[model samples]
Target: MIRRLFSHIDLMVRLLVLAIVLASVLPATGRGYVIAQGVSNAAIFLLFLLNGLRLPRTEVLRGISHWQFLLPLTLWCFGAMAVAGKGFASLADSTLPSTVALGLLYLGALPSTVQSATAYSSLAGGNVANSVIAAALLNILGVFVTVPIISLLGGGEGISLGADGLLKVMLILVLPFIIGQLFQARAKGWIVEHREIVTWMDRLSIAVAVYVAFSGAVSQGLWGKVSVGDWAVLLALVTGFLLFGFGGSWLCGRMLGLSRPDRIAFLFAGAHKSVAMGAPLAAVLFPPAIAGMVLLPLLAYHLLQLVVSAPLANLLSHDPNVG
Candidate 1:
């Protein structure tokens, strides 16, 4: 059944339509809003756990040693975006607020994605295990690193991570994967076999989140504060960043003279970032109003990447040059 489903592109099309509809109503309905937030957190946890399960023991450990390109690139790309995005505020006419700083810091702070990056890597004919290791490692490191950097960049309005909060992040984000890893052989196979279920749940979760987040913005009068022009500017920035990360990683991997599989792995795995990962973490780290703003550019980035990256993935997949 799952194999038949995978053969049909229409399933994705249909699910996407459903996601669009659900995203429309998530904000106004209070129950749905809370459920969306819960699902967002739960889905991220599931994604991390599934990622850990796929990672071979060796690659998981080697993620530390294999800091070759990914580590520097992650920092560099994030730094570049922060510097570039913050300055973007001056070009716009919106009332200057802490969001300018927060947006820039968020550029530097959010983790690389786990499931989507790995899936993109796999779809692009990359080494799935290596991608999993890289993605998962990025996620773990994010808890320790994001807050301090945000604090530095944010100044008076910055964020911080207490020891207890860090512990809780580890518990919520790390411990689930640790447990999943113990039973991975059983779970991963089932998930892979039921790819439709996994895809549906993942997309449903994200759609609900976008709905709630965007809805919350409406309720908070973001439209009055953030104009159509601001949205356009934000959209442009996100598109550019996604292009840079994906293309830059590919070029970097090629320059490293990696094998085809490894280069492909690095390209896709190193490129993608997560907006979903930021929502809960932002709630934990920042004031509520500010947290929502922090989420905005990320949401833009996430959606832009999906639309832009799909064709890029297909192009890479069939590229005679890659092999």
Candidate 2:
């Protein structure tokens, strides 16, 4: 029983949860906040560097060739999810807070997560290569697509499309990836040999990001701003959003005549949102006052997805029929 329980929970989840607890307790104002922010930024940059180095070029090429599979996945990530976000907000009427609702809509518009999606897809016997390429493209396009969608939804109030933000995305996320890909041939053997090191780095970076983001929120009296009832409603909406993504992706992939591996890729790539990018993007997009509120839903959704997906990935790994 102990082994079974331990097997189900991922270390990354545990670290992130711990980080949140610590963030809540720790002092985030004055010099501490500045220090936390700097650490978070550095960790994030390194995380992307490892991500670029680890991507398998062969799978990326294969994934790109299947444009038929890619098209719907893209549409679902950007279009269907965005529509569902607004629809859920409307359904909430006056129950949901405006800031949280706007956050959900923005979350929907954000891109798929590269690291977790690729990792989960690989664990589930999915097409890792295709996932890698698809996830990368989504983030790249996300820099452009997310801002526009947020603007359309009135979530872009006080947000400016700064060249610095776009450049930051490229510098932190894309540039490292390109460099890694460039030297991939030379590093492939070493990277594969030390894959576990890369995984830990990814987890640590995310944990730091969570800590910094929540530290700011905690400092701002996040719990005071949001009532228990509001929290419940937001949780419910986030749960519904995830369920829709998971179920719809599986159903739609089948309907589109995808192979089992392709379906698995679709399932993960369409369902997972980029926690790696969410906080930084929010910082760039929203005002400091509302940014914490806007960030809460994204953080909640990020943690929840990892919890839900871990077991699903385990099941898929064991199921002989899935691969």
Candidate 3:
């Protein structure tokens, strides 16, 4: 009986960890004020630090050359999604805040997540090293360049970018990642032996993030601010964005002349945005009310992709070229 349950045990364990975190929050709403805020902030900071430490310094400064295989199509994929959402925004204008329009646009403007790209690349049999390097660089550069795009398309309610933002990116994100990497290297053998521990943190972060997002909203009584009708519209937008990512990334993969495996990596890595990154950026870029609104799409997008993309990823990896 235990053996039967142990099939895909890693995935099961991950889900279990998330469930535990969710359970923890249900008790006191996870709103220990300073404790919650500090832990949440440290988790993201430490997560990035691990990223920095894991990646080569040279690569961080001067990324992999796969843009020949990725950039144009990736940009166009995100661009078209932004246009599609805005095009249809008129239908839901009455339900969500006008800022929802800006939130949708701004989240699309941010770069894809680094770690998820690499994780999916490995799962799909892509060049893991290349995907890892590319993902890290794109995110680092995104901190610098993502702001201008937001400013241009964000109309008026987007984030501000400059030296200050860059500093925050480095201190909060880059430094901690470097620390994690250095610490990992010293204990490289130990880490390898304890791979399960790191894996636990990966899933645990998602669970923590979900609980924090939901609990924070509940604690503030902000859950009441948006009604069922508004939620329906948010769900619709999330669905559209996920599908757009899948379809758009596919076309980009073709345009970039990627072999099937590379295409699979490009599609998942290049297209998935980080709510982890977005939440902080939103808080910095917009007003509190608007930032909360901005996070809605990211929250929706994160959950939708986790469920929808497992099957999609499996299908992509089975392609002959991927094998």
Candidate 4:
């Protein structure tokens, strides 16, 4: 059981940690930084392009009909979580660096993860169809919705997305996704056939983004600004945020009277945040230094979710109520 649980700390997590460590020890600078950023941007573009190619339009269409489940899930992820993040940010403002505190809010406004959410939902005997659809729809909407929510909630904190930022998002994230979708008919099968390579591409792109972002933060004294006490506080706050996400999502499902399988889907779907989206979007929306700091809470939460989900999925799989 312990070995199985630890397996959740998979290769991707290790890569992420390695990226951070590399950034801490040997951060890119000057010409190297510029080159790294360009590479990171290109990687992000390819990542979204692949995302577009892989997700089936038919699944999205079918899932739209499950509005009974998706609607509440969407509202919870965007609305309730955004509010909770704002509250958490406010609480952390006095204790942590401003950018780090604001990270909690950014984390809240982001959408659910596609891969892990679906994988865990399946493991827990949830409605896999709904989980897939929910993940795709939320990520699609997140490209548009997350920034606006951050702008709305954190605008006073200098987090607004101006015209340039919007255009960058369109080019880097949305445009490639649209392109991939357009080519899906011709390319998706090939992508699926080469899924192993594509998955590694996804991981590599994310790792580059994280490495570039954290490099900037490290250059700007990221470690020095965040003391040990701040680390404890950050951990505590992240834990609270995780509990609220899973607990609130489950309660919302129960209150809406969803079936047990659906509740499991809701639990994972509503709770998990996407580092895939968050990292790339941050690269587009903020400078490397600010993006790195802004990603702190998200990075922590993403890792913890992986650790927690395996055991939780096992428990849910055995639950008599999960029919």
Candidate 5:
């Protein structure tokens, strides 16, 4: 009975909720902010390093070789989703805050999740190899794609990155990744052996980033600016966004004539966004006051997708026709 109850709960979602609550209640003043930022930065780098060490290079190459699945998945995740976000934001401008609207756009531009997407793909009896490749490539490119996309979307008000700033951000993230990759062949067994620890480290870093971002916003009167009604509207908008992504991707996958497993790959990989990438990117791209709001939609979408996808994965797994 206890196991069943625990299985139903989303621990990551709970952790995020706790972070927000703590950020609101705690005094994250000068010293707190300094310490949090320092810790958050280190965590972010380590998270990427761990990812590089664990990334399956052979699977990625094999997945990419199958262009039939790769092409549509890429289009949906990067191109189509981004345009949809802009359209939604424009349509809802009067109701949603500018920061929140931009947050939706940020979500659209961000990459598909590697771990969750792959896990769901496997659960659903999908083409796990292809899912891994699609997810991996999207994230690898997201660091490059996201910055330019933000710049293109009216970056005059601090959304823009100067050449040096862009270079620095790239180097900070990319250098660690390269270093990890270099050590991966030698360290792969050890890294994979301690996979759970690495996973928790990544989650902890994101939680800390959330705490730091929200604490800064709270200190600057975040709750004062946002209303209860705003939360309701944001919830609805985020739900709609997820539905659109999932429905559209599924339809496109079918229309493109992908096989069952390949379609499942697209369905899972194309429909989700990465909070791991989103949180750190927001920290780099937006100021603290607005970063929290920018993060709000992502937090909502991330939790929503997991909740919705899990049941869908279960359904697909049980269906004899799916695999």
Candidate 6:
């Protein structure tokens, strides 16, 4: 059981470590940086295009009717989590770099993950269909909503998104997704047929984005700026945010009188932040150096969520009330 749980995490860690080390050693500079940035942007565009192809409109429509489940879930994810992120960022501002501190708020503004949330919900005997719809809706909304939230909360913290940044987001993320939806009938089938390839493409795009971003940061002295004590503080704060995400989401479910399965769906949907959205959005919203710094806390949170969620899902699967 333990082996099964750690196997996936082990592979994820290895890949991420490789990306980080590669970025550090051969950090992109000069004309190479420009090329890397272009590649990252193109990969992100394709990644969203594939995302749009995969998510069915029917699922989104069906899920919208369940306001009882969806409303609180949305509020918790965007409202409560955003507020918590602000509070944590305030706490970390004095201890960490300003950009990294602002990342806490950015993390809160992001949406729930689609793939992992639905997978864990199914594993925990939750409403997989609801999980799918909830995650999809949030991601769609996030495309429009996340930047506004950041601009609103992060204006004073040197994180404002000007017109150019907004346009970049539309071009890189939103435009490709709209195109994918338009061609979904034709391309979705091919995407499904080549699911393995599509999945790898998703991972590769994210890795490339991270690599470009981190490379910029490394070249700008990222390692020298962030010390051992700063790492400890970052980890501690991220763990606290994780706890609040899971615990507060569960309590919200209970308070709302959700059935066990629906609650399970809500729990995962509301708690998990999407790095799928984070990495690309950061690339679009900030320069490579700042984007890399902003991503530090999120990357840590993403890995820890995976580690914590596997065990939590296993435990939830054993709950007698989960039916």
TM-score of each: 0.71, 0.83, 0.74, 0.96, 0.93, 0.95
The pairs that clash in candidate 2 are: none
Candidate 5 lDDT by residue in tens digits, 1-323:
99998667776676788889999999367987888877877888887888788776776677678878887788888889988877766655788778877887888888999889999999998888888888988888888887777556535444745776676566657777888878889988888788788778988888888888888778888888778988898899889899999999888888998888888889999999998889877776677777788888899999999989999999888985643
Candidate 2 vs candidate 4, TM-score winner: 4
Give the Cα error of residue 95 in candidate 1, in Å: 6.8
Off by over 4 Å in 4: 1-8
Better of 2 and 6 by lDDT: 6
In order of lDDT, best first, we have: 4, 6, 5, 2, 1, 3
- lDDT per model vs. reference: 0.62, 0.78, 0.61, 0.92, 0.82, 0.88
Lowest summed lDDT across 10 adjacent residues in model 5 is found at: 151-160
The regions of model 5 sitting more than 4 angstroms off are 1-7, 154-160, 320-323
- Per-residue lDDT of 42-98 in model 1, one digit per residue for the tens? 765675566556565666678777777566646644564445444553333254344
Which TM-score value belongs to model 5?
Answer: 0.93
Better of 4 and 5 by lDDT: 4
Output the better candidate (5/6) by lDDT: 6
Query: RMSD for each model, in Å, please?
Result: 5.2, 3.4, 4.8, 2.1, 2.2, 2.2
Clashes of each: 0, 0, 6, 0, 0, 0
Error of 1 at 266 (Å): 2.5
Candidate 6 lDDT by residue in tens digits, 1-323: 98887565645455666778999999999999999999999999999999888887777788899888998898888889998999999999999999899999999989999989999999998999899999999999999988777777777455546787778888999999898888898987798889999988998888888888899889989999999999999999999999999999889888998988899999999999998889888888877778889999899999888888888999899965542
Residue lDDT tens for model 3, 197-308: 7656655554454445445544554456777877888788778777878788777778767777677777777667776566655544553334555667776676666666
lDDT of 2 by residue, 11-95 (tens): 7667867887897788466787888677767787777677667766776677678789888999999999888877776655478
lDDT comparing candidate 5 with the true structure: 0.82
Ranking by TM-score: 4, 6, 5, 2, 3, 1
In model 3, the number of clashes is 6
Top TM-score prediction, candidate number? 4
Error of 4 at 250 (Å): 0.5
Question: How well does candidate 1 score on lDDT at residue 200?
Answer: 69
Error of 2 at 2 (Å): 9.0
